[model samples]
Target: MVVTALDLVLAGLVVGFGALVQGAVGFGMALLATPLLALIDPAWVPVPILVPAMVLAIASLLRERGHADWRGVGWAMLGRLPGTFAGVALVVLLSPRAFAAAVGVVVLACVAVSLAPLRVRPTPPLLVTAGLVAGVSGTAAAIGGPPVALLYQSASGPRIRATLAAFFAAGTLLSLAGLGVGGAVTVDGLLHGLLLVPFLAAGFWLSGPARVLIDRGGTRPAVLGLSAAAALLLLGQAVLG
Candidate 1:
């Protein structure tokens, strides 16, 4: 596929903003970027978006490595393995519009759950469950952060960012591998992702200051609001298309 300069600029701006949000909150890059990227170009969904997401995850993890909950990450990874396989299957089976609609539903559901009065703790079992859900969503649609982020909503900002960063860093690799096995990894997708890396770096740099604002009690609202907006946009596009 031939991408024009305009496409690159639009994608860069979307990715940069997504990276900034993810860097500050630890889980919005894919959640915010995937649907928007898909809207820009259907070919950019899972693999291309996953590449920058992986970069952001590694960067966030490095910045807050000491605060991550290793045990929780381990449990999540355990579930991610099987879930990734399922996600790859969906990727192969679904049409682009169908996939977008499905992702929209998942994000909306997650937002509703987060807004509810129920309190969720990141116990071993729940972490595994979140990981499983994340694997499927992240692999298929690249919007896997909400499930895990909800579990850590009440935790300190640094811990939430660090732990999620660790989970995504490994989980994204697993998803990419699954996509490769499923024959969903394309050279065009990779090149597009590489083109967006500099934008991601700029976003990550800006996030250093943004993190302070998030830490001052803006995390949950930001997560929920951005998620809902993206989900709505995705669903609208699917229906209209």
Candidate 2:
């Protein structure tokens, strides 16, 4: 479908909201964008909407993490590559509804994982394991944040955001490359994803202040809100069946 002006506006707003959540917690670009955009125009959701928006968001997101998060990011990237290839391959083979349902299931599982206890802080080995899981799940589903997110739940605020951002940045770049090589990315997807750039920028800017709120100490609300919102998005899609 040629996007109507109203559809553009709706997509823009959805991008903005997703960005806000990213600013708030340092993830959620795909989490927020995928479901909402899918609801709007399933035609656009797969490549047009996700491919470019995520590419831009990841590019902008990684600057701050730099040297600090490299080791973990590297490990995650290693696993993420093959996993993402597997995911895109699945996308090619599966029917559209099957793909959407598969994504929904993975996302919902992430929500449940997030809600569980992280009382025992993560060790390096755990981070490595998370990276492997993230790589596979994200490659297939395009929702890799949960695996890394769970890994970082016990860290300080800055560490959490920076690490996750770095992981996403690298993983997305890999996924984008694989998708492009597979000829999964088309001009239409590029244009649609490009249109959401403003929203992505807005989210980046908004993160500055949200970072303050995050720095103040309490993170229960942020975690709770994201978990609920993500789960709701998935459940809504499943119920629409």
Highest TM-score, which number?
1
Residue clash pairs of candidate 1: none
Tens digit of per-residue lDDT, candidate 1, span 60-123: 9999999999998999888889989988887778775787687778778877887888876888
Q: Which residue pairs of candidate 2 clash?
A: 48-189, 80-135, 84-139, 87-140
- Consecutive 10-residue window with the lowest summed lDDT within model 1: 30-39
CA RMSD, predictions in order: 2.1, 3.2
lDDT of 2 by residue, 14-62 (tens): 8777777776676776677777787788766656656544654464456
After superposing all C-alphas onto the true structure, candidate 2 shows an RMSD in angstroms of 3.2
lDDT of 2 at 151: 58
